[model samples]
Structure formats: C-alpha cells, structure tokens
Target chain A: MEPLTLDEKIRILTESARYDVSCSSSGSSRSNRKGGIGNAAASGICHSWSADGRCVSLLKILLTNHCIYDCAYCLNRRSNDIRRVALTPDEVAELTINFYRRNYIEGLFLSTGVVRTPDYTMELLIETVRKLREEHRFNGYIHLKLVPGADPLLVERAGRLVDRVSINLELPTRESLALLAPDKSREAILLPMRQVSGLITARRDEGRRAPPFVPAGQSTQVIIGASPESDLRIMTISEQLYQRMGLKRVYYSAYVPVTGDTRLPALNSLPLLLREHRLYQADWLLRFYGFTAYELLEADAPNLDPELDPKTGWALRHRQLFPVEVNRAEYEVLLRVPGIGVRSAKRIVRSRRVQRLRLEELARLGVVMKRARYFLTADGMTSGEADLSSERLKALLLPEKKKRSGPEQLSLFPTNDSDLSALTGEL
Target chain B: MAIWRYDGSFTGFLTLCAALLSQGEEPEEIISAEPLQNDLFRTIISVASDENRGEKMLAAIASRISPDSCRLLWQAFLSEAPGVELLLWRYLSFGRTTGVKCDRFLAHPAVGPVHRLANSVGQEAHRLMGIIRFQETAGGQWYALVEPAYQVLELIAPHFAARCSDMNWLIHDRRRSLAVAWNKQEWRLTRFDAQGVPPLSADEKAWSTIWRGYFAAIAIPERANLRLQQQHLPHRFRKYLTELEKPPRR
Candidate 1:
C-alpha cells in the first residue's frame, strides 16, 4: 500500500471530522509572545463559516482516520472499508502553522479516530500540539480531542498545551453507548473528562500565576437523535455536566446518517436539526438565562416544542410569569420574559434607572418587542390587547408558516440573497 | 441655525465639536468638507482642524463619560453614517451634562442613533476578523484585501498583529484606499495602492486551492443554507475570500 499524499490525508481526515460540530474558537486569551507565530483572542474569531452554517473557527481535522474501535455511527468506524490516512506530528504542526500564517483558520481543532490504542492516539495528538507550542512557538488557540481511556498524565500534558479539550459523549446514555459503540464504555469517556475538569479547577484555584490547564475549559458533544434518549434526558445530563463537571459548553450535533446499519435510523431520516436547534436554545437558557432543566421540562413533557422556541414555550407553560412590567421588574424577572435576552434584560435594568421606560424605549434597547409585547408592559400599559390565555398566546406567538421560505438551495458560492440571520445562528 | 463643516478626519470632527461647545450654541448640522452639502437657510461655518482642541475634547469626554464611551464615539465616527457628526455632538453634549450615566438613556434622541451606529461598526469589525483571508505574496508576506461596510481597519489590525506576529502582513481596505502594514513587530496605517500587490507564487496558489477544496468538502450538502452563509458572511466581504472566489477557468 502506498503512503497517502498530504491532500489525500486531509481529505480523509477532514471528511471524518466534519460530523463533529463543536467549531467554537472562543474563551481563551492566549497572547502571542515575542517569537510565537499566533495568539488566541478572548472573544474567539470565526475565520469562516462552512456551507452548513457551522462556524469555521479552526483548522478542524483528525490526526488519522484509522480506528481500533468501531463506533456504529462514526464515519471512520473500523468496520467501514474507508481509505485510512494519518499525518505525522511534523506534518500536523506544519499544516497548522502554515494555515494560521495565511489567516485560513483561528487555530487547529485536532480530533482523531482511536488508532492502535487510546494512549497511542492520545500521545500522537499531544506531540502534534506540543510541537506546535514548543517547537514552532505557536501560541494560537488549540481545541484538542482527548481520546477516551487515555493515560491521566497524557491528558494533563495535552490540557496544558491546548486552550480547550473535549471528549464526545457520542450517545446520551450508557445503554446507547453499549448498543451503538461496543468498544467504548461510559466510564472510559467520563474518566478523562473528570480528570480534565479537576485539573482546570485546581489550576484556577491555584491562582492566575499557576500554569494553565485548558484555559477555555472542556466542552463535549452529544449526537442528537442517534439514540432513543429524550430531550429532557439530554438537557438533564447537560445541566449535570455544567454543574458537576465544570464544562464550558455542551454542543449538540444533529446526527447525519453515514451508514446503513440495521440498528441505526435510515439515511433518509431528517437530521433532527430543529431538535438540535431547540436544544441549543434551551442550553443557552440554562447557561445564561438562569433556567433549570426542571423548569424547562417535566417527565411527562419530554421534548421541547418544535413550533416555538424553548424560552417562549417555557413562558407559555407558566403563564402566571407573564405581563412582567418592564419598567419595574427586577433583572431576573425581566430575563424570564420571552422576547428579552441577556443583553436586552441588562439594557432594560440600566436604562430604566435613568428614567421611566415606555414601550417605545424597549425597542431601542434591542428588545424584540414583537415577541415581548405579549409578556411585558411599560409605563403601566400592557402591550395592547394582550392574549392572557396560554393557548391563545401560543397561537399568537407562533411564527407564521407563510413567513418561512422554501428549503434553502445550496449554492456553490455565497449569493447576494443569502440571509445573514439564518447563517449566523441568530435564530 | 449654523452648519459647521470640518475636514472629515476624526480629529477635525472632534475639533469642531469642541469649538461648538465653547460657543455655547448648538449647530443645526455638522458636515465633513469632503462630499460637502449646502443648506439655503443655515449659516455654514468652516471649522479649522485643531489637534490640541481635539485631544482636549476627547480627554474631557473620556473624563466625563467612560473610556468605553470614548471608544464608542470613535466607532460611531468610523461607521460613516449620514449626519453622524451631529449625532456625536448631541451625544457628547448629553455626556457632558449627565456624565457617563448618559449611556443608559437609550431612548434619548441623541443617544439612540450613536449607539446603533457604533454597534453596527463594532459588529462589522467582529465579522471581518473571520472573513478576511490573506494570500501569500511572492516575498512570503501575507496580503489580504477587504472593503468592509465600515472603516474598521484600525479595529481589526491589532487582532491580526497579535495573531500573526511572526509574519510581515498587509491588510488593505480597498474601498477606503487605506492599508495597515505589520512589520513582524508593530503595525502602521498608510495610503494603499492596489496595483502594488504582487502576484501569488505557485505554492501559494496551490495552498489556496487546497484551502478552497477543504472549504467546499466540509460543507454538508444536506444542511447547505446559503441564506445563513450570507448572513454570517455578507457578499461584500466574500469578494476577496479565496474559498468564495470562483475557480480559474481551465
């Protein structure tokens, strides 16, 4: 067998990596030193956006597509007869630096299929990043994928060099992991996550002068709609990860079927994008809006409303919370309103302190009054003809179907008519 | 009513702002001398650019308003919005009277426009950080050309400087004819001539092709949303982006 060229290697590795959707390149502020080639911004920069609307924040690629374990849903599963290729540590480092120099990426997002052994793959990944940081003096943001069941010391060394490290919880539950990924165990994945989390906290507690261990913290991805897990279960796990594991983000990747396995859903099944999107919205609420999992979902109501956003759905379920006076309501109370996000709520709190705020004033403060009008009042005036009943309000608040255009057609290149809000996940 | 006209530079605008404040009379409008406009009834006053007065005015605003407010004022000036000068004057006057607290008054006639303008400029600068692509020139210097909706060259230069400290790079704002050049240490802004850009080397061209290939390959056809792509990266920013550029005819 001939050794694959660099282009062939990139094609195979990137093709394998495209399914993992944790493209965020934020949360670290690694500045460039005198001789270093790159730096990381506190607020991450998105170098580009793929046609899928996912951010192209980093040079996202895999170290190799060869695997020792076969995960049923993964593109690079061992059972699959796909062409396998691996780049040497030098190749990886050189590619990252060259790409960084050209401003083609913020940094490298290096994940891999388990090759030979978990520790071996982990060591290879560590060497690639280690070379970038030590040999090349590259101070750019690196999001390394910590191979499950790798050595703790290897995890520590990798954590120190990279800005972030993530281990994909591929499936939501242990049962699903056993069913879909016979080679991986629930404990194998969580152990490294726990270690990374513990190291990050210990480093923080040791003070700023202490050596950084994953300064951006750890994040994980869960494949949505792959296993038969409810949205409630997913959010509950996410909430736990946030509270107990100290994870920065829990990315939900909509499952795109790559195989015709008897156990998996058919290839034609919709990617559950709306569900993934709703989960992201709910995740945002949990992380930023002070909403708990219980507040968002109950045992009986397992999934988020497909038609309405999670916040608006939650607002409808608890109608008593509505009609909060924007002028007099507390900051927390204002944040609960369907239309008011974190920014708008803070704006309202600050702006109202200067003078009494009227309904018109809320619009200027970036509040989406179109949605907020039903739940908020200003200057003792309700948004005029408010529908207090939950059903009626839900009906009124639901986005009109006619307003939604047809399925977006893929363009070879960006068109002038491309909708910006749709692309940036502003939705 | 008097309309004050000054050179379009930020310093010139600040100088006029200080002059108007000293006179203790509000002007009907503040206009830049370039793209000069006329009003039949209003008296037009040509305010000479004064660096010291401008610095003093900026410092006074910084002292009264927050430093962040001064930054916002600068961003609004970069927005190049119609009647932005008048908006800044009104916002500065409000700031002088109310101090930094004036920022919270979102609904104030003067504050709203300035806030929106600054926000737009800031947003554009943030977007350009990702969309701007550099191609390697014959001399191995990285060169990227952009024509952002706002004057954000200064806003984005520091970011590139910090990220690409090892390489000499030049970012040209084609629309403004301004270029920011970083010489592996510090950066300086100068007038740019587009013709001076050297052609790409064969290796550079091949790397760009590979990059474009990667970009094309990574996009999931099942979830291709051109609308979303356009939203995150507008058409204006895509002109120089290698991935978005059309492939050369065979």
Candidate 2:
C-alpha cells in the first residue's frame, strides 16, 4: 500500500474520533508559560461549528484506528476493514503546535484505538502528549482518553500531563457491555476512574509546587439508545458517577450505526438526538438545578418525557407547587419554575432585592415568560387568561412545538414560545 | 436640556463623562461628534478629548465605584451602540451616589442598559477570540482579519498575545480600520488601512487544506443541521474562517 499522506491520516483519524462526542475545551484554565504556544480559557472557545451543529473546540483526532478489541458499536472495531493509520509522536506534536499557532484549535483531544496492548497504547498516548508539553512547550488544553485496562502507573502519569481525562463507559449496564464489547468489562473501566478520582482529590490540598493532576478532572461518555437501558437507569448511573467518581461531566452520545453487526439495533431513522438533548438538560438539572435523578424520573416512567424537558415534566407532575410568588420565592424554588434557568433564577433573586418584580419585569430579567407565566405569580398577579390546569397548560405548550421529526432546530431570532425555549434550553 | 458630543475615541468618551460628572447636571443626550449628530430642539456642547481628565475619571470610577464597574463602563463604550453614552452617563451618575452597589441594582433603569451593553461587548469579544483565524504570511508572521460588530479588537488582543507570545502576529479589524500587532513580546493597537496583505508562506496552503479536510471529516452526515451551525457561527464570520471558506475554483 502506498504511504498515506498527512491529510489522509488526519481525515481518517478525525472521522474515527467524531462519534465519541466530547469536544468541550472548558474547565481547565491553564495559562501560558513564558515561551509556550497556547493557553486554556476557563470558559472555553468554539473555533468553528460542524455541519452536525456540534462546536469544534479542539483538534479531536485519534492516534490510530487499529484496535485489538471488537466493540460492536465502535467504528474502529477490530473486525472492520477500515483504513488503519497511526501518526508518530513527533507528527502529533508538530500538527498540534502548528494548529495552535494558527488559532485553528484550542488544543488537541487525543484518543486512540488499542494497538497491541492497553499499556502499550497508553505509552504511545503519553509520549505524544509529553512531546507536545515538554518538547514543544505547548500550554494548551489536552483531553486524553484513558485506555481501559491500562496499567495504573501509566494512567497516573497520563492524568498528570493532561488537562482532562475520560474513559468511555460506552454502555450503561454490565450486561450490555458483555453483549456489545466482550473484550471490555465493568471492572477494567472503573479501576482507572477510581484511581484518577483519588489522585484528583489528593492533589487538591497539596502545595502549588506539585504538578496538577487532571486540573479539569475526569468526564465519561455513555452511548444513549444503544442498549435497552432506560433514561432513569442512565441518569441514576450518571448521578452515581458524579457522586462516587467525582466526574466533571458525563456525555451522552446517541448511537449511530457504524457496522452491520448482529448485536446492534438498526435504526431506520435519525440518531436519538432529541433524547440526547433532553438528557443534557436533565444532566444540567442535576448539576445546577439541584434535582435528583429519581425526582426527574419514576420506575413506571423510566424514560424521559419526549414532549417536555425533564424540568418542565417535573414541574407539571407536581402542579400543587405552581404559582410560586416570584418576589418572595427562594432562589432554589425559583429554579424549579418551568422557564427560569440558573441565570434567570439568580437574576430574579437579585433584581427583586432592588425593586418589586412585576409580571412584565420578569421577561426583562431573562425569564422565559411563555412557560413561567403558567407557574409563577409576580407582584400578586397571575396570567388572567392562561388556564392553570395541567392538561390545558400541556396543550398550550404543545401548539408552538413542531411535530418531532428530527433534532430541534434553534432559531437565532426566536419569534415564538417554543423557539425561545429551544434557544435557551432553560427547561 | 443639553446634548453633549465628543470624538468617538474611548478617551474622548471618558473626557465627556468626566465633564458630565463635574457639571453635576443631567444631559438630555450624549453622542459622538464625528458625522455631525444634530438635534433641533437641544443645545449641543462639544467637549475636547483631554487625556489627563479621562485617566482621572477611570481612576475615580475604579476607586470610588468599583473596578468591576469601571470594566463594565469600558466594555459599554466599546460596544459603540447608538445612544450608549447617555446610558453610561446615567449609570455613572447613579453609581456616584450608590457607590459600589450600583451594579448590584440590576433592575435599575440607569444600570440595566449599561450592564446589558457591556455583556454584549464581552460576549462578542469572547466569540471573536475563537473564530479569528491566522494565516501564515511570507515573513512567517501570523495574520488574521476580523470585522466584529463591536469595537472588540483590543478586548481579544490580550488573549492572543498571551497564547502566541513567541510569534509575531497581526489582527486587523477590517470594519473599524484598526489593527493590533504583536512583535513576539509586546502588543499595540494602532490605526490601519486594508491596502492589501502579504503573500502566504510556503506550506500554509498545505496546512490549511489539511485543516479543511479535517473539519469536513469531523462532522457527522446523519446529524447535519445547517441552521444550528449558522446560529453558532453566523454567516458574517463564515466569510473569514479557513475551514468554513469555500475552496478556490479549480
């Protein structure tokens, strides 16, 4: 075979890594050293947006696409006859520095397929990152994928060198992992996570002289709609990961069929993007809105409500809590309102301190009044015409919602109520 | 009622603000003098741009009101939104009495517009920090062109300066005719005209081609949502982004 050009190698590697779906360059605030090439902003910056509407934050690519394990849902599974290419450590470092100088990327997101052994692949990843950091003196954000079943010392070293680390628990349940990825196990994945979490916690109180151990902490991704797991089960696992593993984020990647495997479910339609979006909303609720997974979901209603967001669903189910006075409601209670988000909830609490909030004033403070109008009272006034019945309110919310054929398209200038909600994702 | 006007520079704006504060009288309007803004019913007072007074005004706001409020006032001035000067004057007057607590009063008519304008400038500066792409020039310097809606060239310069301190670079604001140049150590914002740009360095095209390929390959065809893409990276920005650029005709 003719040697693959750098362009061919980059295209192949990026395509293989695209399905992983964790592109955030935030959380780590690594400032540039005296002669370094880049820095990480705490808020993160999106260099470009892809056609799929995902933000292109980093140069997300793989070291190689050659795997020993055959994960049925993975594009780089061992059984697939795809083109396999791997860049050397120097190549990776040079590419990253050039891209950083050009301001084309925040940093590099380096993930890989297992080459020969987990430890060996981890060493390759570590060497590439070390070259970028030590050899090139690059001070940019790097999110390295912790190879499952890698040696503990290798994982520790990789965690120390990078800003963020993640190991994908591609499927939620052990049974699903066994069915789809027989080579991977629940224990092999959790060991490194537990190790990194301990290291991250231990390094917190250490002196500034100690090298930061994954300053952005760890995040993981789960394949939504891949297995038969329900939203309740997924959220419950996410909650556990947050509490137990001290994870920063748990991404939900909707399964798009990459292989004609007998184990994989064939979807004739689009990937479950709406489900993924709702899960992100539910995740935000858990992290920011102070909602429990069980509170957002019940045993009978295991999956999230397709029509309404998890917050709005929770608000509708608990209608007796409605019509909370905006002027006097606690910040936490204000967060529970259907249309109010963390920002608006804080705004409501702050602005009301200066002046009594009226029904119209709530909109000026960034409240999505279309949904909040049904649930909040401002200055002892309620929407006179809006019917408070749950059924009627649900109907009112449904009219502006277009029939779901695909992912919700957000309009920049949102003229209607549903468009506004889609724009803010407040609910 | 008095309508005061000054040159559109930040120093000029601050000089106008300083004059307004000393007068202890409310102006009906504050506006830029260039392009000659006229109001038929009000008297217009033209204030000269005094640099020392502008510096004094900034220091006073930083000490008396709050450094945070001072930053907000600067950002609002950068926004160059129509009639923002009046909003800032009201905010400054309110802050003078309210002290550091002026920003906390978010719902106040005097503070809200200034705060919102500052937020708009901040948001645009942050966005431009990402979307500003640099092409390698013939002398091995990185050059980027931007036409941001707000006067945000200075706001984003510190970021690129810190990140790319080892390299010489220039970021030209096409709309405002200003450029921020960094000479591997220090950076300065200077007046510039877009006569033309230097030729591309060798390998620049090759690297860009590879980048465009990666960008195209990274997007999933199944999840193609052009509208959502447009929402985040607006059409105006797409014109300058390398990855978003249309390849030259064969």
Q: Which is the leading candidate under DockQ?
A: 2
- Per-residue CA lDDT of candidate 2, range A1-427, in tens? 9998899999999999999788878888888999778888887777888887778888999999999999999999999999999989899899988888889998999999999999999999999999999989999999999999999999999998999999999999999999999999999999999999999989987977788899988999999777899999999999999999999889888888889998888764333776777788889899989999999999999998767778888988998887899999899999999889877888888878767989878887789888888898999999875456778778876536566665453432333222211222111
Model 1 lDDT, residue A159, Cα: 91
Which residue segments of model 1 deviate by more than 4 Å? Answer: A1-3, A267-271, A403-427, B34-42
RMSD of each: 3.0, 2.8
Output the TM-score of candidate 1: 0.95
Clashing pairs in 2: none
Model 2 misplacement above 4 A: A268-271, A385-387, A403-427, B34-42
**What is candidate 1's lDDT per residue for A354-405, written digit by digit as tens?**
9899988888887888789988889988768675667777888887675655
Candidate 2's residue-wise lDDT over B1-250, tens digit each? 7878898888998898888778876788777754364557678899999999999999999988999988899899898898888888888888988887777778778987787788778878888888889999988988999899999988998999899999899999988899999998789999999666679999898888988999999998877888778777778998899998898777
